[model samples]
Target: MYEGLMQKVMSDSKSKAGQYFTPRALIDSIIRLIQPQPGEIVQDPAAGTAGFLIAADRYIKDATDDLFTLSEDQGNFQRRQAFRGTNGCPTPTAFA
Candidate 1:
Protein backbone atom coordinates (compact mmCIF):
# COMPACT_ATOMS: atom_id res chain seq x y z
CA MET A 1 0.00 0.00 0.00
CA TYR A 2 1.08 3.58 -0.61
CA GLU A 3 0.72 4.33 3.09
CA GLY A 4 3.11 1.49 3.86
CA LEU A 5 5.50 2.82 1.27
CA MET A 6 5.46 6.25 2.79
CA GLN A 7 5.98 4.88 6.27
CA LYS A 8 8.85 2.78 5.00
CA VAL A 9 10.35 5.79 3.35
CA MET A 10 10.00 7.74 6.56
CA SER A 11 11.49 5.02 8.73
CA ASP A 12 14.35 4.48 6.31
CA SER A 13 15.50 8.04 6.93
CA LYS A 14 15.52 9.89 10.19
CA SER A 15 15.48 13.04 8.14
CA LYS A 16 12.12 14.32 6.99
CA ALA A 17 10.88 13.33 3.55
CA GLY A 18 10.98 15.90 0.77
CA GLN A 19 7.38 16.74 1.45
CA TYR A 20 5.73 17.09 4.85
CA PHE A 21 3.85 13.85 5.25
CA THR A 22 1.60 13.36 8.24
CA PRO A 23 1.48 10.14 10.21
CA ARG A 24 -1.23 7.68 9.14
CA ALA A 25 -2.55 7.26 12.67
CA LEU A 26 -3.19 10.96 13.09
CA ILE A 27 -4.77 11.23 9.67
CA ASP A 28 -7.05 8.29 10.34
CA SER A 29 -8.03 9.70 13.71
CA ILE A 30 -8.94 13.03 12.16
CA ILE A 31 -10.93 11.28 9.47
CA ARG A 32 -12.80 9.38 12.15
CA LEU A 33 -13.62 12.64 13.86
CA ILE A 34 -14.77 14.29 10.65
CA GLN A 35 -16.59 11.27 9.22
CA PRO A 36 -16.61 12.45 5.66
CA GLN A 37 -19.56 11.51 3.50
CA PRO A 38 -19.55 10.16 -0.06
CA GLY A 39 -20.38 13.41 -1.83
CA GLU A 40 -18.54 15.96 0.26
CA ILE A 41 -15.64 17.80 -1.33
CA VAL A 42 -12.43 16.83 0.49
CA GLN A 43 -9.30 18.61 -0.50
CA ASP A 44 -5.77 18.66 0.93
CA PRO A 45 -3.74 21.66 -0.01
CA ALA A 46 -0.36 20.30 1.12
CA ALA A 47 -0.90 16.78 -0.11
CA GLY A 48 2.47 15.14 0.09
CA THR A 49 1.86 11.74 -1.46
CA ALA A 50 -1.86 12.47 -1.06
CA GLY A 51 -2.01 10.71 2.31
CA PHE A 52 -4.71 12.87 3.87
CA LEU A 53 -6.93 12.70 0.82
CA ILE A 54 -6.42 8.96 0.52
CA ALA A 55 -7.26 8.39 4.19
CA ALA A 56 -10.41 10.52 3.89
CA ASP A 57 -11.60 8.51 0.90
CA ARG A 58 -10.82 5.28 2.69
CA TYR A 59 -12.75 6.42 5.76
CA ILE A 60 -15.78 7.34 3.66
CA LYS A 61 -15.71 4.03 1.80
CA ASP A 62 -15.32 2.11 5.04
CA ALA A 63 -18.24 3.92 6.62
CA THR A 64 -20.44 3.42 3.54
CA ASP A 65 -19.54 -0.24 3.16
CA ASP A 66 -17.22 0.40 0.28
CA LEU A 67 -19.73 2.80 -1.23
CA PHE A 68 -22.34 0.07 -1.66
CA THR A 69 -24.79 2.04 0.46
CA LEU A 70 -24.52 5.11 -1.76
CA SER A 71 -26.63 5.86 -4.81
CA GLU A 72 -25.11 5.87 -8.26
CA ASP A 73 -24.66 9.62 -8.27
CA GLN A 74 -23.16 9.65 -4.79
CA GLY A 75 -20.80 6.84 -5.60
CA ASN A 76 -19.82 8.64 -8.77
CA PHE A 77 -19.17 11.76 -6.77
CA GLN A 78 -17.04 9.82 -4.30
CA ARG A 79 -15.02 8.35 -7.14
CA ARG A 80 -14.57 11.55 -9.08
CA GLN A 81 -15.09 14.60 -6.90
CA ALA A 82 -14.88 13.70 -3.22
CA PHE A 83 -11.11 13.45 -2.97
CA ARG A 84 -8.83 16.17 -4.25
CA GLY A 85 -5.18 17.19 -3.78
CA THR A 86 -3.40 20.41 -4.58
CA ASN A 87 -2.39 21.52 -8.07
CA GLY A 88 1.09 20.02 -7.97
CA CYS A 89 0.09 16.81 -6.20
CA PRO A 90 -0.11 13.53 -8.07
CA THR A 91 -3.38 11.59 -8.24
CA PRO A 92 -2.20 8.71 -6.12
CA THR A 93 -5.31 7.86 -4.09
CA ALA A 94 -6.93 4.42 -4.40
CA PHE A 95 -10.61 4.30 -3.46
CA ALA A 96 -10.84 0.55 -3.40
Candidate 2:
Protein backbone atom coordinates (compact mmCIF):
# COMPACT_ATOMS: atom_id res chain seq x y z
CA MET A 1 0.00 0.00 0.00
CA TYR A 2 2.81 2.39 0.85
CA GLU A 3 4.67 1.55 -2.32
CA GLY A 4 1.53 2.08 -4.31
CA LEU A 5 1.21 5.51 -2.81
CA MET A 6 4.87 6.19 -3.46
CA GLN A 7 4.40 5.08 -7.07
CA LYS A 8 1.52 7.48 -7.48
CA VAL A 9 3.57 10.31 -6.04
CA MET A 10 6.51 9.52 -8.28
CA SER A 11 4.39 9.32 -11.37
CA ASP A 12 2.61 12.52 -10.59
CA SER A 13 5.79 14.40 -9.89
CA LYS A 14 7.81 16.15 -12.57
CA SER A 15 11.08 15.06 -11.05
CA LYS A 16 13.38 12.26 -12.24
CA ALA A 17 11.24 9.73 -10.45
CA GLY A 18 10.91 7.52 -13.49
CA GLN A 19 14.66 7.23 -13.82
CA TYR A 20 15.29 6.69 -10.13
CA PHE A 21 12.36 4.52 -9.18
CA THR A 22 10.73 1.28 -10.31
CA PRO A 23 7.22 0.20 -9.56
CA ARG A 24 7.10 -1.91 -6.43
CA ALA A 25 4.72 -4.37 -8.03
CA LEU A 26 7.32 -5.18 -10.63
CA ILE A 27 9.99 -5.49 -7.96
CA ASP A 28 7.80 -7.84 -5.95
CA SER A 29 7.11 -9.95 -9.02
CA ILE A 30 10.79 -10.21 -9.85
CA ILE A 31 11.65 -11.11 -6.29
CA ARG A 32 8.95 -13.77 -6.31
CA LEU A 33 10.38 -15.28 -9.44
CA ILE A 34 13.98 -15.12 -8.26
CA GLN A 35 13.27 -16.58 -4.79
CA PRO A 36 16.57 -15.65 -3.18
CA GLN A 37 17.76 -18.22 -0.65
CA PRO A 38 19.90 -18.08 2.45
CA GLY A 39 23.67 -17.97 1.83
CA GLU A 40 23.09 -16.71 -1.70
CA ILE A 41 24.28 -13.17 -2.28
CA VAL A 42 21.87 -10.78 -4.00
CA GLN A 43 23.08 -7.45 -5.27
CA ASP A 44 21.75 -4.37 -7.01
CA PRO A 45 24.70 -2.54 -8.50
CA ALA A 46 22.76 0.56 -9.51
CA ALA A 47 20.40 0.58 -6.62
CA GLY A 48 18.44 3.82 -6.39
CA THR A 49 16.40 3.27 -3.24
CA ALA A 50 17.45 -0.36 -2.85
CA GLY A 51 13.95 -1.52 -3.70
CA PHE A 52 15.01 -4.79 -5.28
CA LEU A 53 17.27 -5.71 -2.38
CA ILE A 54 14.61 -4.82 0.16
CA ALA A 55 11.97 -6.86 -1.63
CA ALA A 56 14.31 -9.83 -1.94
CA ASP A 57 15.03 -9.68 1.78
CA ARG A 58 11.34 -9.60 2.60
CA TYR A 59 10.64 -12.49 0.25
CA ILE A 60 13.35 -14.65 1.77
CA LYS A 61 12.27 -13.89 5.31
CA ASP A 62 8.66 -14.68 4.44
CA ALA A 63 9.65 -17.97 2.84
CA THR A 64 11.95 -18.94 5.69
CA ASP A 65 9.49 -18.11 8.44
CA ASP A 66 11.36 -14.93 9.33
CA LEU A 67 14.60 -16.92 9.32
CA PHE A 68 13.47 -19.07 12.24
CA THR A 69 14.27 -22.09 10.11
CA LEU A 70 17.86 -20.92 9.97
CA SER A 71 20.51 -21.22 12.60
CA GLU A 72 21.41 -18.08 14.58
CA ASP A 73 24.62 -17.64 12.63
CA GLN A 74 22.83 -18.19 9.34
CA GLY A 75 20.14 -15.73 10.29
CA ASN A 76 22.74 -13.13 11.17
CA PHE A 77 24.38 -13.75 7.83
CA GLN A 78 21.08 -13.37 6.09
CA ARG A 79 20.37 -10.09 7.82
CA ARG A 80 23.80 -8.63 7.15
CA GLN A 81 25.47 -10.50 4.30
CA ALA A 82 22.86 -11.85 1.93
CA PHE A 83 21.77 -8.52 0.47
CA ARG A 84 24.18 -5.94 -0.87
CA GLY A 85 23.64 -2.82 -2.94
CA THR A 86 25.97 -0.14 -4.23
CA ASN A 87 24.64 3.38 -4.55
CA GLY A 88 25.94 6.90 -4.94
CA CYS A 89 23.81 8.31 -2.12
CA PRO A 90 26.04 9.97 0.45
CA THR A 91 23.95 8.61 3.32
CA PRO A 92 23.28 5.08 2.28
CA THR A 93 21.38 3.14 4.92
CA ALA A 94 19.58 -0.16 5.31
CA PHE A 95 15.81 0.10 5.27
CA ALA A 96 15.41 -2.08 8.30
Candidate 3:
Protein backbone atom coordinates (compact mmCIF):
# COMPACT_ATOMS: atom_id res chain seq x y z
CA MET A 1 0.00 0.00 0.00
CA TYR A 2 2.70 2.50 1.00
CA GLU A 3 4.89 1.48 -1.92
CA GLY A 4 2.09 2.28 -4.32
CA LEU A 5 1.67 5.73 -2.80
CA MET A 6 5.40 6.36 -2.99
CA GLN A 7 5.42 5.30 -6.62
CA LYS A 8 2.60 7.68 -7.40
CA VAL A 9 4.33 10.51 -5.61
CA MET A 10 7.56 9.81 -7.42
CA SER A 11 5.73 9.87 -10.74
CA ASP A 12 4.12 13.22 -10.16
CA SER A 13 6.51 15.96 -11.22
CA LYS A 14 4.90 18.65 -9.12
CA SER A 15 4.73 16.54 -6.02
CA LYS A 16 8.14 15.05 -6.60
CA ALA A 17 9.86 18.43 -6.25
CA GLY A 18 11.68 18.71 -2.90
CA GLN A 19 10.37 15.27 -1.99
CA TYR A 20 13.35 13.15 -1.32
CA PHE A 21 12.39 9.84 0.16
CA THR A 22 13.10 9.53 3.87
CA PRO A 23 15.85 7.02 4.49
CA ARG A 24 15.09 4.02 6.70
CA ALA A 25 17.80 4.97 9.15
CA LEU A 26 16.36 8.46 9.54
CA ILE A 27 12.89 7.07 10.05
CA ASP A 28 14.16 4.56 12.58
CA SER A 29 15.98 7.28 14.45
CA ILE A 30 12.89 9.48 14.52
CA ILE A 31 10.75 6.61 15.76
CA ARG A 32 13.24 5.78 18.45
CA LEU A 33 13.42 9.37 19.59
CA ILE A 34 9.67 9.93 19.54
CA GLN A 35 8.83 6.56 21.06
CA PRO A 36 5.14 6.76 20.22
CA GLN A 37 2.93 4.99 22.73
CA PRO A 38 -0.11 2.90 21.89
CA GLY A 39 -3.40 4.80 21.49
CA GLU A 40 -1.44 8.03 21.32
CA ILE A 41 -2.56 9.79 18.16
CA VAL A 42 0.06 11.05 15.69
CA GLN A 43 0.02 12.91 12.41
CA ASP A 44 2.27 14.48 9.83
CA PRO A 45 0.93 17.28 7.68
CA ALA A 46 3.51 16.51 5.02
CA ALA A 47 3.12 12.76 5.28
CA GLY A 48 4.64 12.08 1.88
CA THR A 49 3.84 8.48 1.01
CA ALA A 50 2.87 8.01 4.64
CA GLY A 51 6.35 6.97 5.70
CA PHE A 52 6.06 8.53 9.13
CA LEU A 53 2.59 7.16 9.64
CA ILE A 54 3.60 3.65 8.67
CA ALA A 55 6.66 3.73 10.88
CA ALA A 56 4.74 5.16 13.82
CA ASP A 57 2.03 2.57 13.38
CA ARG A 58 4.55 -0.24 13.42
CA TYR A 59 6.27 1.22 16.46
CA ILE A 60 3.04 1.59 18.42
CA LYS A 61 1.82 -1.89 17.56
CA ASP A 62 5.13 -3.42 18.53
CA ALA A 63 5.25 -1.43 21.74
CA THR A 64 1.71 -2.28 22.80
CA ASP A 65 1.48 -5.82 21.48
CA ASP A 66 -1.58 -4.78 19.43
CA LEU A 67 -3.82 -3.90 22.31
CA PHE A 68 -6.04 -1.52 20.33
CA THR A 69 -7.92 -4.25 18.51
CA LEU A 70 -11.24 -2.60 17.86
CA SER A 71 -13.34 -3.57 14.86
CA GLU A 72 -13.01 -1.43 11.75
CA ASP A 73 -16.15 0.60 12.37
CA GLN A 74 -15.35 1.06 16.01
CA GLY A 75 -11.81 2.06 15.24
CA ASN A 76 -13.02 4.64 12.79
CA PHE A 77 -15.37 6.01 15.38
CA GLN A 78 -12.63 6.33 17.95
CA ARG A 79 -10.35 7.92 15.40
CA ARG A 80 -12.93 10.50 14.48
CA GLN A 81 -13.62 11.24 18.10
CA ALA A 82 -9.98 11.73 18.90
CA PHE A 83 -9.47 14.07 15.97
CA ARG A 84 -12.57 16.07 16.72
CA GLY A 85 -11.99 16.49 20.41
CA THR A 86 -8.24 16.59 20.74
CA ASN A 87 -7.06 17.39 17.23
CA GLY A 88 -5.15 14.12 17.40
CA CYS A 89 -4.94 12.10 14.25
CA PRO A 90 -5.86 8.46 14.53
CA THR A 91 -3.93 5.52 13.22
CA PRO A 92 -4.73 4.31 9.73
CA THR A 93 -7.52 1.77 9.58
CA ALA A 94 -6.43 -1.82 9.08
CA PHE A 95 -8.06 -3.43 6.10
CA ALA A 96 -9.37 -6.94 6.28
Candidate 4:
Protein backbone atom coordinates (compact mmCIF):
# COMPACT_ATOMS: atom_id res chain seq x y z
CA MET A 1 0.00 0.00 0.00
CA TYR A 2 2.69 2.45 0.95
CA GLU A 3 4.70 1.53 -2.16
CA GLY A 4 1.80 2.40 -4.44
CA LEU A 5 1.04 5.50 -2.45
CA MET A 6 4.67 6.58 -2.62
CA GLN A 7 4.79 5.91 -6.35
CA LYS A 8 1.66 7.97 -6.95
CA VAL A 9 2.94 10.74 -4.74
CA MET A 10 6.32 10.76 -6.43
CA SER A 11 4.81 10.74 -9.89
CA ASP A 12 2.37 13.48 -9.05
CA SER A 13 5.00 15.66 -7.44
CA LYS A 14 7.66 14.96 -10.08
CA SER A 15 10.13 13.48 -7.61
CA LYS A 16 9.63 16.00 -4.81
CA ALA A 17 8.39 13.11 -2.60
CA GLY A 18 11.67 11.27 -3.11
CA GLN A 19 13.29 13.40 -0.44
CA TYR A 20 10.93 12.10 2.21
CA PHE A 21 11.39 8.36 1.57
CA THR A 22 14.74 6.71 1.93
CA PRO A 23 15.43 3.53 0.02
CA ARG A 24 15.17 0.47 2.29
CA ALA A 25 18.50 -0.98 1.14
CA LEU A 26 20.32 2.21 2.10
CA ILE A 27 18.57 2.23 5.45
CA ASP A 28 19.62 -1.39 6.07
CA SER A 29 23.21 -0.65 5.15
CA ILE A 30 23.40 2.23 7.63
CA ILE A 31 21.86 0.09 10.37
CA ARG A 32 24.42 -2.63 9.70
CA LEU A 33 27.27 -0.14 9.98
CA ILE A 34 25.98 1.26 13.29
CA GLN A 35 25.49 -2.28 14.73
CA PRO A 36 23.02 -1.40 17.44
CA GLN A 37 23.40 -3.31 20.70
CA PRO A 38 20.58 -4.90 22.64
CA GLY A 39 20.18 -2.36 25.43
CA GLU A 40 21.12 0.72 23.49
CA ILE A 41 18.40 3.10 22.39
CA VAL A 42 18.08 3.50 18.62
CA GLN A 43 16.18 6.65 17.84
CA ASP A 44 15.41 8.50 14.63
CA PRO A 45 14.40 11.99 15.74
CA ALA A 46 13.43 13.23 12.30
CA ALA A 47 11.85 9.94 11.26
CA GLY A 48 9.82 10.22 8.11
CA THR A 49 7.46 7.24 7.94
CA ALA A 50 9.79 5.40 10.38
CA GLY A 51 11.77 3.46 7.77
CA PHE A 52 14.86 3.39 9.94
CA LEU A 53 13.03 2.31 13.05
CA ILE A 54 11.30 -0.52 11.22
CA ALA A 55 14.55 -1.73 9.69
CA ALA A 56 16.36 -1.54 13.01
CA ASP A 57 13.65 -3.53 14.72
CA ARG A 58 13.94 -6.22 12.06
CA TYR A 59 17.72 -6.29 12.32
CA ILE A 60 17.63 -6.64 16.10
CA LYS A 61 15.10 -9.43 16.05
CA ASP A 62 17.03 -11.27 13.35
CA ALA A 63 20.25 -10.91 15.32
CA THR A 64 18.80 -11.99 18.67
CA ASP A 65 16.73 -15.09 19.16
CA ASP A 66 16.55 -14.47 22.89
CA LEU A 67 13.52 -12.30 22.43
CA PHE A 68 11.38 -15.44 22.38
CA THR A 69 12.96 -16.91 25.53
CA LEU A 70 13.13 -13.76 27.62
CA SER A 71 10.87 -13.28 30.63
CA GLU A 72 7.95 -10.89 30.41
CA ASP A 73 9.86 -8.15 32.22
CA GLN A 74 12.90 -8.64 30.00
CA GLY A 75 10.71 -8.70 26.91
CA ASN A 76 8.99 -5.52 27.99
CA PHE A 77 12.31 -3.82 28.57
CA GLN A 78 13.62 -4.92 25.17
CA ARG A 79 10.47 -3.73 23.43
CA ARG A 80 10.65 -0.38 25.16
CA GLN A 81 14.39 0.06 24.71
CA ALA A 82 14.67 -0.77 21.02
CA PHE A 83 13.67 1.33 18.03
CA ARG A 84 12.06 4.66 18.82
CA GLY A 85 10.92 7.05 16.12
CA THR A 86 9.55 10.53 16.59
CA ASN A 87 7.92 13.34 14.59
CA GLY A 88 6.60 11.23 11.70
CA CYS A 89 4.16 13.16 9.59
CA PRO A 90 0.77 11.96 10.86
CA THR A 91 -1.16 12.17 7.63
CA PRO A 92 0.02 10.77 4.29
CA THR A 93 -2.42 12.90 2.35
CA ALA A 94 -0.87 15.95 3.90
CA PHE A 95 2.24 15.22 1.88
CA ALA A 96 0.26 15.66 -1.31
Candidate 5:
Protein backbone atom coordinates (compact mmCIF):
# COMPACT_ATOMS: atom_id res chain seq x y z
CA MET A 1 0.00 0.00 0.00
CA TYR A 2 2.73 2.41 1.00
CA GLU A 3 4.73 1.49 -2.07
CA GLY A 4 1.82 2.46 -4.28
CA LEU A 5 1.35 5.77 -2.49
CA MET A 6 5.04 6.51 -2.69
CA GLN A 7 5.03 5.77 -6.40
CA LYS A 8 2.11 8.11 -6.98
CA VAL A 9 3.50 10.84 -4.79
CA MET A 10 6.88 10.62 -6.41
CA SER A 11 5.37 10.66 -9.88
CA ASP A 12 3.23 13.71 -9.20
CA SER A 13 5.09 16.79 -10.38
CA LYS A 14 2.74 19.31 -8.78
CA SER A 15 2.75 17.89 -5.21
CA LYS A 16 5.34 18.92 -2.69
CA ALA A 17 7.82 16.08 -2.65
CA GLY A 18 9.05 16.93 0.81
CA GLN A 19 5.61 16.24 2.27
CA TYR A 20 5.20 12.88 0.57
CA PHE A 21 6.65 10.74 3.32
CA THR A 22 6.98 10.61 7.11
CA PRO A 23 10.24 9.41 8.62
CA ARG A 24 9.99 6.03 10.33
CA ALA A 25 11.71 7.34 13.48
CA LEU A 26 9.20 10.17 13.80
CA ILE A 27 6.30 7.81 13.23
CA ASP A 28 7.55 5.51 15.99
CA SER A 29 7.86 8.45 18.39
CA ILE A 30 4.33 9.66 17.66
CA ILE A 31 2.93 6.16 18.18
CA ARG A 32 4.62 5.99 21.56
CA LEU A 33 3.09 9.29 22.61
CA ILE A 34 -0.49 8.57 21.46
CA GLN A 35 -0.61 5.08 23.06
CA PRO A 36 -3.62 3.75 21.17
CA GLN A 37 -6.03 1.38 22.91
CA PRO A 38 -8.47 -1.30 21.73
CA GLY A 39 -12.09 -0.24 20.95
CA GLU A 40 -10.84 3.34 20.61
CA ILE A 41 -11.20 5.35 17.43
CA VAL A 42 -8.33 6.98 15.57
CA GLN A 43 -8.07 9.04 12.40
CA ASP A 44 -5.57 10.98 10.35
CA PRO A 45 -6.78 13.64 7.93
CA ALA A 46 -3.61 13.34 5.85
CA ALA A 47 -2.99 9.65 6.34
CA GLY A 48 -0.32 9.31 3.58
CA THR A 49 -0.29 5.51 3.29
CA ALA A 50 -1.65 5.32 6.86
CA GLY A 51 1.65 5.03 8.69
CA PHE A 52 0.28 6.57 11.85
CA LEU A 53 -2.80 4.40 11.75
CA ILE A 54 -0.78 1.23 11.25
CA ALA A 55 1.62 2.12 14.03
CA ALA A 56 -1.24 2.88 16.38
CA ASP A 57 -2.88 -0.45 15.60
CA ARG A 58 0.31 -2.38 16.31
CA TYR A 59 0.91 -0.41 19.49
CA ILE A 60 -2.59 -1.02 20.83
CA LYS A 61 -2.43 -4.74 20.07
CA ASP A 62 0.97 -5.06 21.74
CA ALA A 63 0.11 -2.89 24.72
CA THR A 64 -3.20 -4.49 25.63
CA ASP A 65 -3.06 -8.16 24.75
CA ASP A 66 -5.25 -8.95 27.77
CA LEU A 67 -7.91 -6.43 26.86
CA PHE A 68 -8.17 -7.77 23.31
CA THR A 69 -8.78 -11.35 24.46
CA LEU A 70 -12.58 -11.25 24.23
CA SER A 71 -14.34 -14.57 23.66
CA GLU A 72 -15.80 -14.95 20.17
CA ASP A 73 -19.40 -14.50 21.28
CA GLN A 74 -18.66 -11.56 23.54
CA GLY A 75 -16.68 -9.88 20.80
CA ASN A 76 -19.45 -10.36 18.29
CA PHE A 77 -22.05 -9.00 20.69
CA GLN A 78 -19.94 -5.96 21.48
CA ARG A 79 -19.47 -5.20 17.82
CA ARG A 80 -23.14 -5.59 17.04
CA GLN A 81 -24.14 -3.27 19.90
CA ALA A 82 -21.56 -0.63 19.06
CA PHE A 83 -20.90 1.63 16.04
CA ARG A 84 -23.02 0.93 12.96
CA GLY A 85 -25.01 -1.95 14.49
CA THR A 86 -23.10 -4.56 12.54
CA ASN A 87 -23.30 -8.21 13.66
CA GLY A 88 -19.53 -8.56 13.97
CA CYS A 89 -16.41 -6.48 14.58
CA PRO A 90 -15.16 -7.48 11.11
CA THR A 91 -11.61 -7.95 12.34
CA PRO A 92 -10.85 -4.22 12.36
CA THR A 93 -10.31 -3.28 8.73
CA ALA A 94 -8.02 -0.42 9.70
CA PHE A 95 -5.37 0.21 12.33
CA ALA A 96 -7.43 2.17 14.87
Candidate 6:
Protein backbone atom coordinates (compact mmCIF):
# COMPACT_ATOMS: atom_id res chain seq x y z
CA MET A 1 0.00 0.00 0.00
CA TYR A 2 2.58 2.52 1.09
CA GLU A 3 5.02 1.53 -1.66
CA GLY A 4 2.39 2.11 -4.33
CA LEU A 5 1.46 5.45 -2.85
CA MET A 6 5.07 6.54 -2.66
CA GLN A 7 5.71 5.44 -6.22
CA LYS A 8 2.74 7.47 -7.43
CA VAL A 9 3.81 10.52 -5.51
CA MET A 10 7.36 10.15 -6.77
CA SER A 11 6.25 9.81 -10.36
CA ASP A 12 3.96 12.81 -10.07
CA SER A 13 6.66 14.97 -8.57
CA LYS A 14 9.83 13.52 -10.03
CA SER A 15 11.27 16.87 -11.00
CA LYS A 16 10.95 18.10 -7.43
CA ALA A 17 11.09 14.89 -5.46
CA GLY A 18 14.09 13.33 -7.15
CA GLN A 19 16.43 14.72 -4.58
CA TYR A 20 14.23 13.58 -1.73
CA PHE A 21 13.48 10.09 -2.99
CA THR A 22 15.90 7.26 -3.72
CA PRO A 23 15.22 4.86 -6.55
CA ARG A 24 14.51 1.29 -5.51
CA ALA A 25 17.30 -0.07 -7.67
CA LEU A 26 19.84 2.28 -6.18
CA ILE A 27 18.62 1.56 -2.70
CA ASP A 28 18.92 -2.16 -3.37
CA SER A 29 22.41 -1.72 -4.70
CA ILE A 30 23.46 0.19 -1.62
CA ILE A 31 21.93 -2.41 0.66
CA ARG A 32 23.79 -5.14 -1.17
CA LEU A 33 27.00 -3.24 -0.75
CA ILE A 34 26.40 -2.78 2.96
CA GLN A 35 25.06 -6.32 3.48
CA PRO A 36 22.90 -5.78 6.52
CA GLN A 37 23.00 -8.80 8.77
CA PRO A 38 20.17 -10.40 10.68
CA GLY A 39 19.16 -8.46 13.79
CA GLU A 40 21.32 -5.54 12.76
CA ILE A 41 19.69 -2.16 12.87
CA VAL A 42 19.65 0.04 9.77
CA GLN A 43 18.85 3.73 10.00
CA ASP A 44 18.53 6.67 7.66
CA PRO A 45 18.87 9.97 9.43
CA ALA A 46 17.83 12.05 6.44
CA ALA A 47 15.15 9.66 5.37
CA GLY A 48 12.53 11.31 3.21
CA THR A 49 10.08 8.42 3.29
CA ALA A 50 12.35 5.62 4.52
CA GLY A 51 13.26 4.35 1.09
CA PHE A 52 16.62 3.07 2.30
CA LEU A 53 15.23 1.44 5.37
CA ILE A 54 12.45 -0.19 3.38
CA ALA A 55 14.98 -1.47 0.89
CA ALA A 56 17.09 -2.93 3.67
CA ASP A 57 14.04 -4.70 5.05
CA ARG A 58 13.36 -6.14 1.63
CA TYR A 59 16.94 -7.28 1.35
CA ILE A 60 16.83 -9.13 4.63
CA LYS A 61 13.49 -10.71 3.83
CA ASP A 62 14.68 -11.75 0.44
CA ALA A 63 17.85 -13.18 1.91
CA THR A 64 15.88 -15.40 4.25
CA ASP A 65 13.03 -16.26 1.94
CA ASP A 66 10.58 -15.31 4.66
CA LEU A 67 9.09 -12.03 3.55
CA PHE A 68 5.60 -13.46 4.00
CA THR A 69 6.27 -15.57 7.07
CA LEU A 70 5.24 -13.00 9.61
CA SER A 71 3.93 -15.65 11.98
CA GLU A 72 7.51 -16.20 13.08
CA ASP A 73 8.92 -13.93 15.74
CA GLN A 74 12.10 -13.50 13.73
CA GLY A 75 10.06 -12.26 10.81
CA ASN A 76 8.25 -9.83 13.06
CA PHE A 77 11.55 -8.57 14.40
CA GLN A 78 12.94 -8.15 10.92
CA ARG A 79 9.89 -6.21 9.81
CA ARG A 80 9.55 -4.00 12.85
CA GLN A 81 12.83 -3.81 14.72
CA ALA A 82 15.54 -4.12 12.13
CA PHE A 83 15.26 -0.72 10.56
CA ARG A 84 14.32 2.86 11.41
CA GLY A 85 14.34 6.21 9.62
CA THR A 86 14.44 9.63 11.18
CA ASN A 87 13.59 12.65 9.11
CA GLY A 88 14.48 16.20 10.06
CA CYS A 89 11.01 17.28 9.08
CA PRO A 90 8.28 17.22 11.71
CA THR A 91 6.78 13.79 12.14
CA PRO A 92 6.20 12.71 8.59
CA THR A 93 3.42 10.17 8.05
CA ALA A 94 6.05 7.72 6.83
CA PHE A 95 7.57 7.61 10.28
CA ALA A 96 4.23 7.53 12.00
- Please report the candidate that would top TM-score against the real structure: 2
TM-score of each: 0.71, 0.72, 0.55, 0.70, 0.56, 0.64
Query: How would you encode candidate 2's per-residue C-alpha lDDT over 1-96 as one tens digit per residue?
Result: 655554555564525433446778889999888888888999997676678988998888898999999999999999888888886543323332
Write model 5 residue lDDT over 1-96, tens digit each, in one string.
Answer: 653555565665414434445666798899898776556666666555566766776676566563368666544543443222111222212222
Candidate 2 Cα outliers beyond 4 Å, as residue runs: 1-18, 89-96
User: How many times do residue backbones clash in model 2?
Assistant: 0
Candidate 4 structure, TM-score to reference:
0.70
The lDDT values for all models are 0.72, 0.75, 0.55, 0.67, 0.54, 0.70
- Cα-based lDDT at residue 82, candidate 4: 64
TM-score, prediction 5: 0.56
What lDDT is reached at residue 75 by model 2?
A: 97
Model 3, 1-96: lDDT tens per residue? 664555555555524354445666788799899987544667666564556767776776565455366566545543453221121223221210
Model 3: ten consecutive residues of lowest lDDT: 87-96
List runs of model 4 lying over 4 Å from the truth.
1-4, 10-19, 69-72, 88-96
Candidate 5 residue spans exceeding 4 A from truth: 1-18, 66-96
Better of 2 and 3 by lDDT: 2
lDDT of 2 at 40: 93
In terms of lDDT, the poorest run of 10 residues in model 2 is 87-96
RMSD of each: 4.6, 3.9, 7.8, 3.6, 8.4, 4.6
How far is 1's C-alpha from truth in model 5 (Å)?
A: 9.4
Clash count, candidate 5: 0
Better of 1 and 5 by TM-score: 1
Give me the runs in candidate 3 sitting further than 4 Å from their true place.
Answer: 1-16, 68-96
